[model samples]
Target: MVVPVPPPPLLASHVAVRAAASAISHGRRVLLNGDHPPQVAALGRGDWVKLICGASFEDAADVRNLSLVYTLAGVDCIDCAADASVVGAVNEGIEVAASIVPTVQRPWLMISVNDDCRDLHFRKAEFDPDDCPLDCSKPCEKVCPADAISLKHSMVDGERTLSDPLRGKYEGGVITERCYGCGRCLPVCPYDRIRAVSYVRDPTMTAELLKRDDVDAIEIHTTGKGTDMFNTLWDNLSGSINNVKLVAVSLPDIGESTVDLMNTIYTIMEPHFKGYNLWQLDGRPMSGDIGRGATRETVSFAAHVASMSERPPGFYQLAGGTNSYTVDYLKKAGLFQSSNWNSGTATSEMASSHQALIGGIAYGGYARKIVGRVLRKIPEQFGRVHIEDHPDHLLEALQEAMSLVGPVKGYIPSHSKPFMKQVDRQ
Candidate 1:
């Protein structure tokens, strides 16, 4: 019989150790340049990456772990819901990550609030499962990316019951905390029982959060219908506006009126805007957790905005449909780090401060979905699943996050990058 050779282990412990070191070194080098605030520098370099913890996602345990993982992977900003508890969770995660890699640069903590209730990011999906027909398929449950919906049924004596077809008394409905209100379940529900409940964040509460020392940034979601709502919210937060380093406005693509609306909003914020401003071009909001096609809308929106000569003054970033494929899509559009946007007619604006045409991409649903896979593998017996407690899991999660962030940062697979590879000897 011929001798057989054993394959090397999938991930050696030493590789992880080296990767961690590289992450710290690269993070500091990319983030600590003194030309501007690290995040501002990243925007100017067209490498800024923000991990968006959804404006409505409030699961603290998951948020904490996700924050820790991404912080290690070298994100410039971490955008999350405006809730105090959520903000605390993000900070906790960042602190824990720093403990692991002492040199890891801490990402700016951002809180998201909405001016208009009409914005989809501020809504929640809700319904009563009892209203459904017994024979009806639970399509909503299948479609939900967050796994927020649950249904159970039990069989009766020698027969099936409609009321309890799920193996119990039809005990199923949207889990409030887990639902990020993507609205995917709405169209799939055959009964049309799902309803999206929208609400605006309290400006008073948002201002208070902004005042906190831990919060570094704030993003205002608007419907682009008019600037009256934007003006009102801006005035409400004006007193505390100086507390944060950056103020971001999240808006949708409103066609020809986008630039005009942006200019109007910019004029309103110009006097009061104390720090850097970013325009989040929200394309097909909350659909990133779906699949590849979902990223198209946001990239297309970026292209359209990039082509405009008079696009307002602010760092332009992509949101809404951002996912793994977003970077590739952006490169194809000639907008990824290409400063020649509308060179023939591109009039200088506030964005001229940034070197790149597109500042960066914000990963929301897709970012969570990628890391949530690793998070789910942790055994559930706990008060809270601190990812650091499980070293192996933490390493795996960091790799997943790095895969998404590395491309934009121009991180190559040498020993200097976060993911360490085996060295060959002559």
Candidate 2:
């Protein structure tokens, strides 16, 4: 069987071990071994009589990377050579119990990922020359995030070289560099983008595996180059960066003081983000549990669908809660570049719901307050104060819905919110 190991850098090389091959055509050889029967001449091909019994075919050209198309437990069954030339804890012996056919491609089967590839996890960030000292080479310096590595100076052609500063020299203890071992430079670099090189399943490798002809199945192994390997693929399958519309605003609908204050904020701040932001989707009619809104569920569903379709999907999370944490999640979800969001709901939804998310009414109130604040601060009042009503399209639709609700409309509280509530004693 062919074992395809991760191709390590030049420093460390990986090798494939061949497994053994057993099982010969027992019934056919013994019973009809003597008969050099006809080779299906009637089927129409050339004149070649063939042995009806099976053959324990062994050809060097037929073997290469071995992979288990299917699996029962942690054990695997791959298509390699007659030798145990593969990786895994399976017995070092080969055994072909029945119906052995010689072919190039292995059958396509599902293989469980157990101790499949541990070498990759630890080797995620590897360097050449394990014994290489942290001299001025700065091999990992440019990649450090915390700027933790302090450096000393070394001169070239009479000028002090800053690019490759020697880290804490042993001084007369190992006498090397010229400058006083100043640790200042290291602590100053932000090193925000520092990290080990990342890897993904090689597309060419996949194409090659899919080309297998002997076995009916195909299996691939990864050294876990990323956090969510599966998600990394699917979430990024579609174009990574999705361009959509978004905005920020505040609305009033939750009622119970929250509504009143929110509306007040809209009346005040709506002008700030108005006419600019796109409507957020995860909004409107605050309900039980944020997930109760169809938008929330829909967003999650989109994520799943992306996975199935081998593509990435967009998101509509609110922005006020936006900080390092949310950004990190978005980045991990591969949605950072695809998400569309604004600050408030009232203004955004009021403007448009064209693929947007709406969250808290408090957010809308805040947006309204922003509008009021911005307009109030502007130097001009009349002709200069051009309020854009484009954002109100969704609100307008809701308004028409209310008018059509008829008798049931009286029971339904206005979405605009002078929010009255059912008096539950609880």
Candidate 3:
């Protein structure tokens, strides 16, 4: 008997689109985090939400889809790799999202690069599968969040023996393009085969990408080893510094020296830094997808930085271990938007500014894992499928994105209210 094929995917009706758009506006309008739009009041109100596309995650298709979904969810920025193709993918996704919801704010596009090779975000996992025992169970593949690893075995000569170590060949290894160097797979390899290879991004190419109009921000990942490398990289990009609207420096906690390093870095940027600056307190570093425990380090980092009497001159944001539980953690820590805590070095001015002590949060691995579920449901044949092309998936993805973003923005449930009309766009 022959089976009938399923119907073509249905597009969302105009009414459905309007409802989705209305929900977004309502959510933004009612955000308890602050009364201002996240982009305008993010730093001040501590409600900025940035979608990190992984500094090393170069998957164009995934990046584009994530951009579109998060844009509709109302994030303030989308942080991605510094490559030209990746930037194009992010812009393409943002434009598509705007097309769908016309009034959706165009989030600032930020590119990430590292000054030092030792930084974990600038690495990739590598190993040779040929040396592996055929019978070995692959835990690396199972632990990988990005699905960067693949292995397949086949019987030779259509025969197998218990003693035959070479009975089959492993067909696939790490897909370099998909690997974001999260380092999760490095520890799970029982054979001790997997190792991380680190590299610094080229300054020339980064400067060139900064000149593009679509690019609005730049994140420089530093190892806090010292200011030597950061100074060099900063000087290299000074020529193109005016090209973007904001500059963000991502660094880890190095104890007492952390504040000093931040101050020094700020001094470096102060002369040429015409745009807004933010300090990314990367606590646990790329562990957001692990679980609840991962979020603590970042929250702790924010609290630690918030209490500091001499932090620096810039917005402070949490990263590395951020997840859905982060906002609650921040609220509990009294750092969410407390005006009492002073983080910046300009104590008098900062106190008067009345901006939220902790600016906002950036979601990376955890963000992808949530919406990625719906994206994975789409069939492989529909390569490079725009989330908007499949409105059902787009709406589902938007819902997932909002679940994580809304709480931070103080979104109230619109359970009883009638759907509002869509806003008129310029």
Q: What is the TM-score of each candidate against the true structure?
A: 0.87, 0.17, 0.88
For candidate 1, the 10 contiguous residues with the lowest summed lDDT are 343-352
Q: lDDT of all predictions, in order shown?
A: 0.80, 0.23, 0.82
Candidates sorted on lDDT, descending: 3, 1, 2
| Deviation from native of the Cα of residue 280 in model 2, angstroms | 39
lDDT (Cα) of model 3: 0.82
Off by over 4 Å in 1: 1-18, 27-35, 154-168, 340-354, 413-426
Q: Give, for candidate 2, the lowest lDDT window spanning 10 residues.
A: 12-21
Candidate 3 segments exceeding 4 Å error: 1-10, 13-17, 29-40, 154-166, 340-352, 413-426
Model 1, C-alpha of 367: deviation from truth (Å): 0.9
lDDT of 2 by residue, 196-286 (tens): 2223334333333333332222122222233244333223322311121122221212223332332332343333322222111222211
Candidate 2 deviant stretches above 4 angstroms: 1-76, 79-125, 130-197, 214-426
Write candidate 3's Cα lDDT for 1-426 as tens digits: 999654333344433654665566666643334333346466676778999999999999999999988988789999999999999999988987776677778999999999999999999999888867787789999999998999877467776544576577776889987899988888888899999999989999999999999999999999999999999999999999879877899999998889999999988888887767888999998889888899999998887877778778777889998988888888889887676444442311332356777888999999999899999998889987777777667767777787788777666332212222232211
Question: How many clashes would you count in candidate 2?
Answer: 66
Better of 1 and 2 by TM-score: 1
lDDT for residue 264 in candidate 1, whole number 0-100:
92
